[model samples]
Target: MSEQNLSSLTNIPSTEVAHENYLLAKLILEIQQTPDEYLPNLLQIVRLFRESVTMKPVSSDAWVKAMDGIKNPHPVKKAVQQIALSELLRKWEEDGDEEEQTETAEILCQNLEENPVSI
Candidate 1:
């Protein structure tokens, strides 16, 4: 990741997955602004999902399913992405930080209509 990309990532660290996905959509839209990359974005998405399990602490089966979703980038990818994005949105709504709320809504409104999560 270039300095620009790192700066971009640092600029927003969502407490939940929907906001992460929303921010990621924004990142994709302006991808040309950063270095051409691969796993950084994907990795970030997966990382966001993983963090959700930590935040929620569900059953072992659920945890495994979540991990499995990203561990292999196959049929579960879309589902996992949606789950993560859903979490992000939930957190955004519950978040008390005014800065976070505005940021999350702005990102979500900007991308949700187009992205649709495919799942």
Candidate 2:
């Protein structure tokens, strides 16, 4: 699939974010069956989830629910999530829209405060 299509898939409607979580779970199962084909798409979906979480255009709960579908072990999952969030924040700081930059910074601060990561 084209990068445009992959990006579009990540942009789930806010109202349908719950449905996206279900879809993500199914995708995870599919990836296990066809890793070579599905892995890239799965990573794209995860990037979209990270964008959703950082951008805060959708419910944070929905983003968290979508992340729950990642099949990695607990520590790895946590680390990956943290890394995604950090990278998004860094990217936003560098080049995001001014309004979104402020909003994302606030959300990132709140998340960090609420869920401190252990090294």
Candidate 3:
């Protein structure tokens, strides 16, 4: 995978992606069921699917930058960066919830304005 674009590799057309949607979900469940020793490999596969779905290009740019900043480079930054990236991906997934909450808040504001609370 060196020098290969992971995002492009998993970028299936939307039509084809629809067909694989269920398969992808099932694969996620299977990965959970898979034994511990095999998880690292399975996770890499999951990362590919995540990149494809998010349409975000995944790269080691953050890790590379972190390493460059360190006077004594260690592979620990790689692990740290991966964890940071995973948390970021989770945030991206949850971003839709913010929109829903904003809408609900606006509706509440409208209701409150129409029926102002009396002290």
Candidate 4:
């Protein structure tokens, strides 16, 4: 990725950042649990998922497409994707980190104060 693209990845919306962090962390856990034979593929999937989520106009559609791209002939790959989707849904349904929630609110407030949006 170019430097500009790398910079854009870091500039994801705060709401998306939390989701990305949670997913990445969970992927790390999954990667560790995975057998050596499947580790590389799982890692690649995680990388692709991260890239998809960081794209401009972030949406779940990117994630769904990435998940779908994995070949279905391999049951392990499908299982891993299912697990990731389940974890993502679980995270979204639950109340997230309170500190992160507060930090996001603060950032929003600061942005609003700095650049008031005209009606």
* Per-model TM-score versus the true fold: 0.30, 0.31, 0.23, 0.27
Number of backbone clashes in candidate 3? 0
Residue-wise C-alpha lDDT for candidate 3, range 1-96, written one tens digit per residue = 321333343455646566566456445555556999988888898799888898855469976786666644456775687689668757756775
Which runs in model 1 stand beyond 4 Å of their true positions? 1-73, 114-116
Candidate 2 segments exceeding 4 Å error: 1-73, 111-119
Candidate 4 clashes between residue pairs 3 or more apart in a chain or in different chains: none
Model 2: lDDT of residue 38 = 70
* Backbone atom clashes (below 3 Å) for every candidate: 4, 0, 0, 0
lDDT of 1 by residue, 5-115 (tens): 655664565663468675765666566455658659866976898888779657999989988765655766667776897898788678658897888678878897876
Q: What stretches of model 4 exceed 4 Å from their correct place? A: 1-26, 58-119
Candidates, ranked, lDDT:
2, 1, 4, 3
lDDT of 2 by residue, 9-85 (tens): 55656465677664765565556566587778878988999888888475889778777655434787778887997
Instruction: Evaluate candidate 1 by giving its C-alpha RMSD to the native, one decimal.
Output: 18.1
Alpha carbon lDDT at 93, candidate 2:
77
Please list all clashing residue pairs in model 1, or write none if there are none.
16-88, 17-88, 18-85, 18-88
lDDT, each prediction:
0.69, 0.70, 0.65, 0.67
| Inter-residue clash pairs, candidate 2 | none
Look at candidate 1 and tell me the lDDT of residue 16. 37
Which of 2 and 3 is the better model by TM-score?
2
> Which stretches in model 3 have alpha-carbon errors above 4 Å?
1-29, 56-119
